[model samples]
Target: MLLETHVLQDTDPDLPALLADGFEVVGESWGAEFVIDGGAESTASLERLRGFVETARAAGLEIRELDARDAAAIESLDAESWVDVPTTPATVHVPVSALDVRDWATRGRRAFGALDGDRLVGLCVGAAGDNDFVVVAPDQRGRGIGGAVVAAWMLGAIEAGERSFSAGGALQNARSLAMIRAVGFRVTERWLSLQRP
Candidate 1:
């Protein structure tokens, strides 16, 4: 059997009791959820992301807000991004379905896409009142596409009157953690997901 519990780190919950009850921390990480306060960001991360923006522009990559019409492209990017997630023995291949595409492309969902002459190369999908996920095409890595896309998305979100933002990912995902932190999301909580033996 598998069970999971999400609690605020500040609450000082009883972890020993859970362990004694045959529960083990299957996963735990720092800064799993980062809160983005309006457009406020760490000076360091801001500089980094901005640098990426300039670099991408020089490379002829354009960033823009996306709509329903770009859904298919976003879905394709999603599948490609998922397939490239650093895999391990614990990884699972969850197929992306049509429903998933529709959900990602739903109207009014605040999203952004990066284009190189009309070809979608990156995407930033925002969660309702939550942290958003960013994906850049495999060939697009190291070109600052991921960071630039995120920076643009955050600007758009701020303009839409969203004052708070948060993001979460696996503990081992350093690239994402750095990107989010660069956007000024401090580590507020570390969640311990427990499972039965």
Candidate 2:
């Protein structure tokens, strides 16, 4: 069962002893969202996102909008990014095949990527301006490329009159979680996949 974590927490009227008797949590995913709610991001938030893009530039990565053509180059990198994730049901990822990448690369008004010369080292994209995911190459993760890619995407998305953004990551993936939250995504859902022995 995919149960909201809060449903089993102290905030819930039902105690864990009453609700968790037979279910063992096998994995979890944090769902976050940042919506304009008929408005726009505050000025400070815009500055922070812009700063991430600049920081990525200082690290020698070129951040720019992506198109359908760049998909093949980064398909392998996208697949590789899922390697460290646990195979449990909740965290299972469908690697973005080259075709899948091509399909969504040009969607959502525009998507963005961080490139090291001719190589795509990180990408942030989704259909219709939703925050599907971001993946940075293993060697490039700590330098904020992932965050920059997403920030750049958000900048474009906001300018395009898009308002709603949503993203999710494994609860255990601190780096992924922090990157999204740093851009103002708030955790709205915490889903725990449970199994019966």
Candidate 3:
């Protein structure tokens, strides 16, 4: 005996449009960056995105990672103290998914926390990738915490067999640029992004 199965097709016009052209609505994502599927969009889409990147670059933004220990302190610092400053939507929050210490530990990535007498004052998260350490955090600003965190992370990365560490900062963010410079991370690339219309 043989059995046949039939799959019902979606009736929504947008569904077909999206599927036929490989377009899909993006969900809310956490972290420093989000990926978009453009499908069959025209050059105009690329142009618009480029314009957005240019504008954001003009606004001064920065991106870099802290040591795992400092990354762990982010939650405590934000919870215990008050920081009076404006944070970019992209820069202020870390995804809960990335904070799974157990998973990171299993994968050989170390998570570290800075302490102020048993209270965590800063945290850092670093991963081994492309022979470099990728760090992420939100509290590495003011009071030289950023540099300290990166220094720790770099040492860990070196011990883990990474020969070099790389990071990025926006042209507009003076504080972040200064912190990265203080830690001796040279500029390697300029990044930009845009949302679809």
- Candidate with best lDDT: 2
Error of 1 at 160 (Å): 2.0
Question: What residue runs in model 2 are displaced by over 4 Å at the alpha carbon?
Answer: 1-21, 37-41, 105-110
RMSD of each: 4.3, 3.9, 15.0
| Sequence-dependent TM-score of model 3 | 0.47
Ten-residue region with minimum lDDT total, candidate 2: 4-13
Tens digit of per-residue lDDT, candidate 3, span 87-175: 33223434333265435666666544444344454444566522212222345336444444455555555556665444543345566
Q: How well is each residue in 1-197 modelled by candidate 1, as lDDT tens digits?
A: 43455332334557777777877666655543433433545445446656766777888998887776777777787787776565322323355444565666444456777899978898777755464567878887777777778777766765567656666665566776776675556677665666665
Q: Name the top TM-score candidate.
A: 2
lDDT for model 3, please: 0.41
TM-score of 1: 0.74
Error of 3 at 36 (Å): 35
Q: Candidate 1's error at 165, in angstroms?
A: 1.6
| Alpha-carbon runs more than 4 Å astray in model 1 | 1-12, 29-52, 86-108, 127-129
Give the least accurate 10-residue stretch of model 1, judged by summed lDDT: 87-96
